[model samples]
Target: MSGSVNMDMFGTPLQKLFSLMQLTLVIAGLMGLVLLLWLLFRALMPKKGQTKRGRKGK
Candidate 1:
């Protein structure tokens, strides 16, 4: 006897929606991580021309 397999159950609109949601979450997480790293770098770095701000030319 030969058996036939059905692929109709997996090709529904719900599957597409779930895939889209997963992709959105992944992208959002990556952007949040990048922002956190940038903030840390800014806080740890120093300012430039700090001594020349208050003094004028003699």
Candidate 2:
């Protein structure tokens, strides 16, 4: 049969793999955005009982 596995995986298998990779990338991007937002909030907002030193100084 000159056995060919390469010919078989080119169909649904490849499509499934591509879709999985796309989903992974999308989830990773969402997580990165959430992390970025959290970091931005932490950097911009004052901690408990602490005022903005920059505002106070100015």
Candidate 3:
């Protein structure tokens, strides 16, 4: 029917909006995870010049 065709055309924009939103959420979550890991590593690591081998430099 003519009405159905009109409805289908309108649905395309909604689909595109949802796809973009999903992509944004995925990228944001991955970036957050990377930042969290970096913070954890920094917190767990030793301070500068604390290790005997670190002073030797290699």
Candidate 4:
């Protein structure tokens, strides 16, 4: 059989590879951003069991 290159899901082999790489990078970046935001929020917010000292009687 002659050498025949079959098209991938993204049309050609090169395109498919590039598309997959781009998708991977995008997902990784989003996950990193989410983790950073979560950490920032946790750092800024107070713990549930602790309350402000002067606000207890209010």
Listing every candidate in turn, what is its Cα RMSD in Å to the true structure after a full C-alpha superposition? 10.7, 8.4, 8.0, 8.5
lDDT of 2 by residue, 1-58 (tens): 3235444545568766886798899999999999999998778765645656545452
> Which model, 2 or 3, shows the larger lDDT?
3
Better of 1 and 2 by TM-score: 2
Model 1 lDDT per residue over 5-53, tens place? 1233246667667767888999999999999999975665445334333
Q: Per-residue alpha-carbon lDDT of model 3 for 1-58, expressed as tens digits?
A: 9687557756899866776798899999999999999997666556654654454453
lDDT of 2 at 6: 42
- Looking at model 4, the pairs that clash are none
- Model 4 TM-score on a 0 to 1 scale: 0.59
Question: Which ranges in model 4 have alpha carbons more than 4 Å from their true place?
Answer: 1-9, 46-58
State in Å the error of residue 12, model 3. 0.8
Better of 3 and 4 by TM-score: 3
Best by lDDT: 3
Q: Rate residue 56 of model 1 by lDDT.
A: 36
- Writing each residue's lDDT as its tens digit, candidate 4 over 1-58 gives 2234234443677867887898999999999999999997667556745545435343
Candidate 1 residue 50 C-alpha distance from true site, Å: 9.3
